[model samples]
Structure formats: structure tokens, C-alpha cells
Target: MKIATKKIAACAILALATGLFYQESARAAIPIQQWKASNGAQVYLVESHAIPMVDVQIDFDAGGRRDPADKAGLASVTAAQASSGVAARGAEPGLDENALGEAWADLGASFGGSAGSDRMSFGLRSLSEPGLLAKAAQLAARQLGEPAFPEAMWLRDRERMAASIRQANTRPSTLAGRAYAAAVYGSHPYGFEVTEATLARISVNDMKALHRSLVEPCRAKISIVGDVTRAQAQTLVNTLLSRLRLTVPARCAPLPPVAEVAPLAAADLRNIPFESAQAHVLMGQPGYKRTDPDFFALTVGNYILGGGGFVSRLSSEVREKRGLSYSVYSYFSPGLHAGAFTVGLQTRPDQARQAVEVVRQVIQTFVAGGPTDAELQAAKDNLIGGFALRIDSNRKLLDNVANIAWNKLPLDYLDSWTQQVEKVTVADIKAAFRAKLQPEKMVTVILGATP
Candidate 1:
């Protein structure tokens, strides 16, 4: 996901200039109301009377990471079907899966689902009118519990995914991303993509079996935010969750522990057989999880390194100094286990190697001598001051809360994040990098380049 830096920089500068800004001081602690439904489903509720809408997200432990070895796309295929209309013929009848999605989108009631490495998420957003809420909640429940992955629908989606994989072969950006994931994760499930072979291999029975095994109430977390009271939230949770039978599956196996391997001395080059003028270069190594202690430090440090555009070392070096690319960035994608820490940029095919070298050098310089006190302070100030903006809206709060729930983070994490960032001294920054990011161990992939 790309960071919209134009708004970020404008806000960050204002935050930096203001020596002391205390938005949260007067605001009471973000009250997180929690309860268990009769069906053993845990519900997390945050009542925000600020907006006249409600957003509900239900997450199950059944994500794509658990897709069986033989049926690599089963989990994702199942997830997509879940948001499509149910097989039941009720007030909404004869609406096929794809039609249901389009219909919901047309009606202004947003519904969708994604299968990530660790969990499957199904959510709905709509106005909080009691009628709308009830309809939305009922629709969500039906989709969650009774999706029929019709042969026609399955074939269409599978064909689409397969086409994407084929197209990816010719896309340099896609090539670099795929290589980077494979290099960092090796043969781990996280490295696997939705291939035509995988899609063709997935049967309807595979999706049904996976759904039966994984989408259980006990292994789920529910988040309700916006114009909903405790009672309204409880009703919604119970209505949707009570139908779900709570049967916890056996715990997933732990990630095969991965250690950084030596970096490539010669760049790994792939010919996607495309004629794009720009080359996509992605470089980095294994990343940390969400709850890692060094998260706050790495977050702020990365901002200066590349996460903060225009103000970042990468932007200065790659764009301002040499005009190698329009934009460049480095980011840590935190997942259930370790995600990727990737630095990516698109430059003319001729200049891709130079751009990669610049990124590597910048990282090396930081590893040897961490960010200056001034840079560290700027990051800290920006993070702390901008905390309010992050949580200003109910949707934003729901996202943060969902992340906390999915990652099993402390309830008061947002409250404590600022303090942790403030405590990250330069020594701490250096130490964190030394432990987590290895400059020499990063695997570099330059796509759309000559061998």
C-alpha cells in the first residue's frame, strides 16, 4: 500500500514546527468495550457518536497462510465467495455472487473480504439507520455462513486470478515484488502467489472444506465502530455470530524460522519480455511483526530512511540529487509472522542498477551511523503530534482496533505508541537496525534489466 505523502508532509511539517501539541491530553482514554456473545464469539466495540454510520469487521483465523499445499489458492478463493450473496433465496433472491457484490456497492452498503496470511476479514460499512443496519448485518451473516461458490462464479474468479498471474510475468513491478517475497521468505507459504496451476487445481469442494474448517466463531474477532451504542453493537454481534458454530481448528504450525541469508553479489535479473521504459527495483530482507518491541523505533527510523517521502534520504538521493525516479520508498509490511521490509523504486531501465546502488548505500550509511539526533527528534515529534489525526475518525479507529485484535496487541497500544517512540534514542535506533535489518543480507531484484 502506498503512502500519500503530499498530505503527510504538509501535516508533518506543521507538527514538527509546533514544539508541543497535546491533543490527547484532554480526550479521555479510548474506551474499548468488550463482551462475549452466547455463541462464544468475542466482540470489541467502540461507540463513536461523532458520525452517523457504523462499520463492522469480522475476522477469522482462516487466512490464506493456511491454504493447503496442493490447493494454494483455496483460502483466497473461499474468501472471495464468502462476501458474495448466500445460496439462500430470501428477501434478496436469485442474486449471484458477483452480482451481489456489485449490487451492494451500488446500494452504498460496502461489503468485501480478503484472505491475508493469518486471517480472513469480512466487513460491511453503511449508514447507521436501524433498517440499514439490520439489513447490512443480516446480509453479512448470510455471506459469512452460507456462501455457495457456484461453478460459474468460481471459474470466473479463478480465470481472473490466473490472468493476473500471466500478466504479472510481463510487469516488471510484479516481477520484482515476487522475487523479493521469494528471497525473503524462501519456500514459506507467504511467498506463494495465486498461480494458474494453483487456481486450476482448486475445486469447489476444496473451498467448502476450508470454509467449514476455518470460519468458526471461536477463532474470530469482531470490531464495531461509529454510531452504535453498546446495545446496538451487542445486538449486531449476536445476530450475526449466533448462527456461527464455534469450533476451533487445531492451531496452525509455527512459521519455519527464517534467518537472513547473504545478499546477492550479482543482481538477480529477469526478462519479463516487456517494453516498459521503467524498471522496477525492489530490495530488502525479512521484516518484523506488529508486536515486536522495536516496532515504534523502526517506524520512526524508516520514516527518515524512506517512509517519509520528499523528506527522506531515499527521495533526496534518488530523486532530488540524480532524478533517478519520481518517487522511491522503503517500508515494513507487518504480518502475523514476519512480513517484508521492502525498498522500491521505478527508474529508467538503464538507471535501475544505479538507483538500487544508491538505496543500498543509504541503508549502509544508516547502519554504520544511525540517524542524527535532529532526524530522530523530527520523526518522534511528527509521530506523536500526528497521533490524533490517525484516530480522528471512527473508520480509522476501527482499522487500528482491528489491527490490535488481529495482532493480539495490547488494548491501549495507541495510547502507549507515542511514549515508546519518544524513548527510542539514537543508540536504540542503531541497535534495532543491527538486530533486525541486515544491509548485506538484503536480496536485491532488478526487473526489466539486462543480465
Candidate 2:
């Protein structure tokens, strides 16, 4: 039975990876159907009958930002343990982790939970055949609402995670990233590190309390893509959330607001000694939030700066001309609050200083003068040309729909995405960068570098 279950799970994964489940159309315009569920959950759907599979993602406000200072990994652990087991309900017997795994394998479907900086999400992927889909949704609903939070499993997983953390500590990149986050984010929860001590403070009771408080049906944003119509998607969502124990509120109350990420008041520099062959360097400061008006400008500007691979100015100056590092990159991680804008690279300990200097000069120049006409045109062209690949699959399209639901973006956001990119001018890029990034006030961390 175990061998058969393993074979079934492997075949399911293979089918997903090989595109045996869905097909993509060349149509650029994706019309999103948006409505509120009877449970007060926001529903976004992109119906595609080209294939017989459906992908659904439900997101809530429960994420790392809500973690208590002492229990830094609470949200992450809660999401992970949701599928460890489902408690027995009436005559229905409880399913242990092993039993749950076998059940999903038997159905050739997948469902799981994950938490990020801003949201906790549960996703489901199953064939849209009525019988198979109904069974998969029922199982997922049970796992979502009835987690047992078994103490033994928590203890076992905690030890494994601690061991992994110890291994990660030996890596220079990990040390550099940890130090950089602390320096950049200061006391923000975004900088909270999951230490063994923090994990020790997280009890099963805490997980249960968090799940009960935040996983209310009224707070969900459900995004669905694939071979389901509006009526069918509504039914799937209703089943998936039916097991939630909390009553639907008269009106969903807003969660307590988290403090915004504090901007850097002054530059922070850290140098740590290690015996590694290469030095890890990270630099940057707080960036804009997801809803910031400068998002489009920043997105285009970043491509020309460091996000466009070999075509970026950072690559041209730091790697190609100077030969200081094999790869150097920069990015902005915008979330509910301001996220970090980071520039990162690795090089010989001696060349680390030179690489850092080159990166700084390139950023300063770009922010002050902006991209030239040729650079601006190239970035727009690349972004617009490659936009189709962004929604070329069911999973990717589902993610975009989820983003729209979460961020309260317009229904036509995807349709106008290219137009937004095309209209961003050099002046727009310069002004946006100047407004958001502060090179002088940035945090810089260098580990395993020479004195």
C-alpha cells in the first residue's frame, strides 16, 4: 500500500510538471470575475476551460508580521502544522499526518499551507472532474479548519528545524543576510529572526489561538483559475471553507494595524570576520509599499538598474567591466508595509570593497540622472515583450489573481499591465528612485571580508 501511494504521488507531481493538467491560450486579455462570497470572502476567478484542472488559493491576514516578538516563527509554524493532522469530528475519524498524506496521494490531488511576510495562504490543485474535485475540496477543508496541533509532531519538527538552523549558521550568506536584515529593518517584525529560543516559546496552544483568531471565513480572499465557471467556483469555495469553526461575523472587523517599517535615519555598516573564501556584501534601505503609486516606475527602473540580468547597469559595471564578482543583483520586496530594497553580491575578500564601491557609484548615478532614452526604451520593450510569460500557466495566473484580490487592485490590472510599463518615462524612473531610495542612509553588511 505504501509503495502504491508513493507511485501515485510521484505520478501526480509528474502530471503537473509536464502540463498534463491544463493548456495556455495566446490571448493577452484575461477578464477577471470578482465577487464576494456568501461568507464575506472575496472571490476572484479567471475561467479557462482549455483544461480540466483547477487551482485555488485562499489568503488571509495571518502572516509573519503578526508573530509575537518572543514567538517569531509562530505564523510560519502554524501554517505548516495545519496539515499535520485533522482532529476527529463526530463519527468521522481523525487522520494522522501519514494518513493525510496517503489520502491526498490516493486522490492524485495536492493541498498545502504557507505563510509569507504579509499573508498566510492555503492552495489546492485538483482535476475539475466533479467527483474528484468534491473529494479534494472536502479533505482540504478538514485540514484547513481542524488541525490537531499534536504536541509530539511539534517537538519533532522543532528539533529538525533547529538542526537546519545550525547548519545554515555556518554559511556566510546566511550570516550576512541576517545581519543585513537587522541593520535595515531595526525593530520591525520583518527583521525578526527565528532563533531556537523563539521556537521554544511557541506552544501548541499558541498555534491554536492564532489559527482560531485569524482564520475566520470572512477574512479570506479566494482566487480560482482553471475549468470552473462562476457558479462552480462559488460552490468549491463554500465547501473548502465549510469546516471553519468560527461563525461568520455581522461585519468583519479590521485587524490591528502593524507598525510600518521605519526608514533608516542614518547609514549602518557592519563587518564580520570569517574564514570563507568569498565575502558576502549586502546594501540598501527601506523601499516603498506594494500600493505605492511609484510601483510601476520602480519596477521599470529596477530592470535597467540590476533586475534585467546581463543587460543591467549593475552587471555591466560590477561584473563585466571590473571582473570583481560573477553576479550582482538588486531588488525591492514591497509588501503590506515598506519592504527592503537590497543590493547583494559576493567576491574575493580583497575585491569586496571594490565591488561595493562600483555598485554604490552605479546606483547613485542612476538615481540622480535616471536611465537614458535608449535604456528606458530597452527596459520597456523587454518588460512588455516578456509580460505574456508572466501569466502563461494556471499557477502563475492564479497568483496574479490572488495579488489583485489581496491588494485591492482593479479587475483590469493584468490587461493594462503592459500599458503601465510602456508609459513609464525616464523622468518617472528618476523621480521614483529619488523619492524611495536613500543611498547615503542605506545599511551595508560585509561578512568574511578583509580588514
Expressed as tens digits, the lDDT of each residue in 29-82 for candidate 1 is: 777777766565678887766445677889987776777666776777788876
Q: Which candidate leads in TM-score?
A: 2
* Overall lDDT per candidate, in order of appearance: 0.74, 0.89
lDDT of 2: 0.89
After superposition of all CA atoms, the RMSD between model 1 and the true structure is 7.2
What is candidate 1's TM-score against the reference? 0.84
Question: Who wins the lDDT comparison?
Answer: 2
Candidate 2 — number of clashing residue pairs? 0
The pairs that clash in candidate 2 are: none
Score every model by TM-score. 0.84, 0.96
User: Which sections of candidate 1 miss by over 4 Å?
Assistant: 1-28, 89-95, 98-108, 248-275
Deviation in Å, model 1, residue 278 alpha carbon:
1.8
Show where candidate 2 strays beyond 4 Å. Answer: 1-26, 248-250
